[model samples]
Target chain A: MSEPLESTLKPGDSYVQSFARGLSVIRAFSAEAPRQTLTEVAKRCGLTRAGARRILLTLETLGYVKADGRLFALTPKILDLGFAYLSSQPLWQFAEPVMQQLAGELKESCSAAVLEGGDIVYVLRVPARKIMSINLGVGSRLPAWCTSMGRVLLAGLPPAELEEQLARVQFHSHTARTARNLDELRTRIAQVRSQGWCLINQELEEGLVSLAAPIVDRNGQTIAALNVGAQVNRTPPEALLEQCLPRLLEAAQSISRLLQIKS
Target chain B: MSEPLESTLKPGDSYVQSFARGLSVIRAFSAEAPRQTLTEVAKRCGLTRAGARRILLTLETLGYVKADGRLFALTPKILDLGFAYLSSQPLWQFAEPVMQQLAGELKESCSAAVLEGGDIVYVLRVPARKIMSINLGVGSRLPAWCTSMGRVLLAGLPPAELEEQLARVQFHSHTARTARNLDELRTRIAQVRSQGWCLINQELEEGLVSLAAPIVDRNGQTIAALNVGAQVNRTPPEALLEQCLPRLLEAAQSISRLLQIKS
Candidate 1:
């Protein structure tokens, strides 16, 4: 598990420690440890057994977690917490039809994600096909330094914040084509910023080729990124750029226009 | 907003009051009130301004909620909380491909939902076309008493629990075809339980016809529901039952088998 970001926060009158810990407990249950015993949950979340027990029971009482004998797991009611975010932002709803159209036209999976810390969290996704070995859904997170959507979102960030985020990344090469160093990544982000779009070729995965464009607000600030992914063998970079990029840009622009009206 | 469920629970040693309150604050933001001021949030969540402010600040610190001047709104990071649920339950992941294929075969919108409180929360949705006036997506909630997926999920519950859930619903007739009273709804639910599938003809919305089957575990427990929806104009009730029912049942059974293997 990644380090608990909450641990860094100094609890004050404004910071609810118990609330933060509850979130930590929720985050502790991941793909690796979906179902865990009390001790396991405590250890993973960096909490005492007593604290974890209280939080777990609280979750159970609220119908967010279910206890199956000795093990505990999150229930579907927990989706309401995520739905709270999706329903609040009408931007995602507006982006969906446009994305669906783009995915149909291009015959590729289309997604929209926003920069969250050092990652991009997919808020909306319309899949034309399963293009990746790793299955990604609405809430899926990918490293911001390696993904097409990531770079587009990163390009939207101010230089100082972008640098800070880059410094925190424990960069490991996913493939030979992935940006190797801080300078290369910065250059790529700079290119995305200049060109107003990004195309990642076999960086995150060997056969994955994706192109991304920014979904901006009224002020032209990029709030989210829109991307389309295909296989390298199926569509070479030339074909992707020539055939798909225009439609991708148009869809992103259309979403941006909708967002502007909504805002 | 519905009555806060946490208010009914007594504050015991195991119950985290601050955590529950924090969740209430999060839930306070919805489709009706996407962004709110401190006073508005406190009023909606039944918290004191100071209490709401602290929780909101804490949420902002965690990157789940963002502050725009005086207004607070949930950020995309909040989806991570929902993602936690989706990532933990491998059922939704396993069910997605099956849903996609079923949607493709039927040329209709396919969905999987689980019973949560008095509602069914959509976990997986694969849309072949925009069939409904309401755009349903993952985390979207619908009344269990009305939706076909809800009826399938409700039928899966033990009789006493099902009765309790039905009693809690604020029953209202959504359409002329909707069951008018408790007895009528009970009869429909009983039929669904006996037949092992459900077909709702324009009960939830006008011109919407939906058929649903339960996705069961190894023990024959309905863990989730799989549904396919189309317009009444495009496909009559007979066609939905004759043509779509077999595919829907096959898909649901296939998912059940996959769940059995995983468990």
Candidate 2:
């Protein structure tokens, strides 16, 4: 759940309170609550009924949201906002074909993500088959501490920044193999940094195994992480490392080269 | 280009000016200008530098926009806004596998889109291979008058709504094959409405042919359109109709059935 509008921030001169409230209203509508009444939106966003009403009306006027009698839902135009980010960043376009090839070669799912705050946000995903209970796609987020892509992305950050991000992580043990503490995570990320790839065995979810490599920019800075994931029953961790790791690294490097040429 | 912020709307009690301006600022950054200085953002958004600055700063503070020295660019967090729409609308989730199967079977790209204004915005896409010069993905927009999916979506609207949308379209002859005027488009849309499907022969772009069918809700009201597109040289219009049409209609009907069952 997003922090309620009231306690999250005090309206400052530079801050647009109405804009913040509008975003809060948008965020309040999730998969769990796809449709909401005015009162539901108001309560969830921590806005006065009138404030939520105005924001919702404004969104309706903009064609981003529509009302079905008493309930409001986002329209497809809401996608243009996200496409702006994807279209602007050329990296994903460069990564997609490479990731698709990797997925095809390995007969698994491949994904690329960039580190954002304490999480990794998927930017590109090419699935050979569905391997996880969670349906992840572009824009889906996962905890950086447990996900293979997340760890590779974290490994790219400067030590001080990495430590800062790690400190902020509200670690949850998703599986028995998840790193137990900050120190353990730090050690894992260090291993990734030195090895140029990271493999996680059922840390994010049971029966899931994934290997990830960094896609670096012209300056050798890791801009994104590429990953391939499979079910453990179908492909054991050792098999994954032996069969997929080399190809995953090659794909990542190919994308990195493209980024360098473009940049 | 979006209308300049100043003349677009009068700020009423229900209209959130800051929120509108924020959206304008976000739209100002596109493929042409992915990164811009504060002055450029202000000029493009038709806002004073201070107004643009505040929004940019607030966006940066919110982690949606990042500053690279003097330039401001959107970060991947902006995708969360788009993902909210995708995640909430169960339609796309239901459409993906069906569209993928259609694309695989037809050996062509299959897509599903919803009509937003005079454009069809892609909601789900499964590409067999890259065929179009323009790289299209989810959230990409194509003019309704020239696209098979767009015509089917337009056919869904009430007569008055369709006319109103048609009047707003800045008709461009993308190719000689595109519908010449409002009357021609109206006839085409009417044909789609009665025939239950639409096929465009290189109307949007030369050598591109596509066939589209409607995805309807429980009420048999068209909610979206699904399409299969291929190069004209590879798949002639007659082949598309005779060979691909039955399968396209079947795939679309399958999705509509799923929607009815779920709804």
Candidate 3:
């Protein structure tokens, strides 16, 4: 019997070269460009037209895409990609109702997020209203250390991993309030851990103030965090902490209990 | 300097092997298994453990995945995969609020959906209450012929493509009410086109009655369908047609106007 020699890869190592390239093609679609011609996709993904055509065609055949004459775009069926993740990811299910409740209670956009390398990937975002200036919708991502959720999640990381993660990214000042020094970031994370909450005042964006609290499982390990954000004019940092923090903490506790109940 | 090769892929083919394999790995994560050990992934993807490991690790490095010890799971960052579709797909933006408002006004779930081959995938689903038996979330797919939205979408499809799609799937009945014959389906679609709407008594599930109207863009081409679903007891078929049809049609018109509005 002959066996296919699957490439040997270490933990966290790269594998399946074609797969990575294919993903690049998919990633080429953005808020600005949802529908693209084959030439645009090829240019975006750095693939030859023939190469892009193959992937797009295969994807179309697989029902992940819908081709409209010369234009190629993803269909709603493509949502199955993320749907598969949300259906399987227990944290999203647990965080959903809590985020919804938090959004209603705070009258602000409340979201649950986890740190992914340099970004805070929003798992669940219960938006408060339409015409949000931030435009950070569910499935949107922002630099982790720059946001309240990122600070809280970073605070929860083990020392070695935390250091490793910090080392990987070149800390640059995004706003005047953003911490540019590693020592300062370390101190900030320590404060966040000790305080059991993190507040980013105009760090990510001026006029966008947010407060966050860590969500820990029964094991006391922080798996996720809840963050509430609003415009600075609508709710100042003082009001956010005073009015929203208690309810946020309660929701976080309830989410923790739910996670434990499932486990 | 050598010019880059243009990627000209046919509808039936793919060019980037790595991209295909990578996407297949991403697709491998589903409702049944969100997280998997390296060995499990290898088995599911038909790759050697080493091959799977590299892909998984690379994904992890890319911030799309996270590994806790031996088990790996997709990160919420993965929603970027679908969010890309939602944010870029211009039709849903116009339809989302209209669908939500219609759901509220009608006191039933309202959705905007497009057809995908033999399936009707929900692009936007506005829920009535927090709890429903069907987790018919956005991006969820159901067999099209059995659904009002599906039927409407099929009615819009060119006859040749419709025939091809019909010939492909085994008309397995989801419920006793499901139409089992291809001829009956064709007739139903034609009637839906002629009548401007489709009503399914309980084709997909018992007691689930739905009324749907086509959502056409300014070009008057059916891009998707707007539908309302409720318990059979809540609204008799005749009443649903009388009461809900106008609202559905009105909402559909509003959405069309919104899509055509200059941003």
- Which predicted model would earn the best DockQ? 1
1 or 3, greater by DockQ:
1
Q: Write the per-residue lDDT of candidate 3 for residues A1-263, one digit (tens) a residue.
A: 13322234433333434555666766788768888988899998999877687677767756567677677887676687777777776766777777766775677878888776678877776556343535455677888877899989989989998888888767777789888788888888899989899888997778999999988888899988898988999899999989998998888888988988885
Instruction: Write the residue-wise lDDT of candidate 1 on A108-224 in tens digits.
Output: 888999888889999888888444324788888999999999999999988888889988977789999999998999899999999999999999999899999999998878899
Residue B7 displacement in candidate 3 (angstroms) = 11
Where does candidate 3 chain A have its weakest 10-residue lDDT segment? A1-10
TM-score of each: 0.93, 0.93, 0.84
lDDT of 1 at A18: 75
TM-score of chain B of each: 0.91, 0.92, 0.90
Model 1: per-residue Cα lDDT over B206-234, one tens digit each: 99999999999888888899998888998
Q: What is the lDDT of residue B189 in candidate 1?
A: 93
Candidate 2, B1-263: lDDT as tens digits: 13222344345633456777888888788777899988899999999977788788778767789988788999888988999988988887777777767776777878899988788999877666333323587888988878999999888888788879988988788999888888888888889989999999999889989999999998778899999888889899999999899999999998999878885
Ranking by lDDT: 1, 2, 3
Which is better, 2 or 3, measured by TM-score?
2
Candidate 1 residue pairs in clash (backbone atoms < 3 Å): none
Candidate 2: Cα lDDT at B244: 95
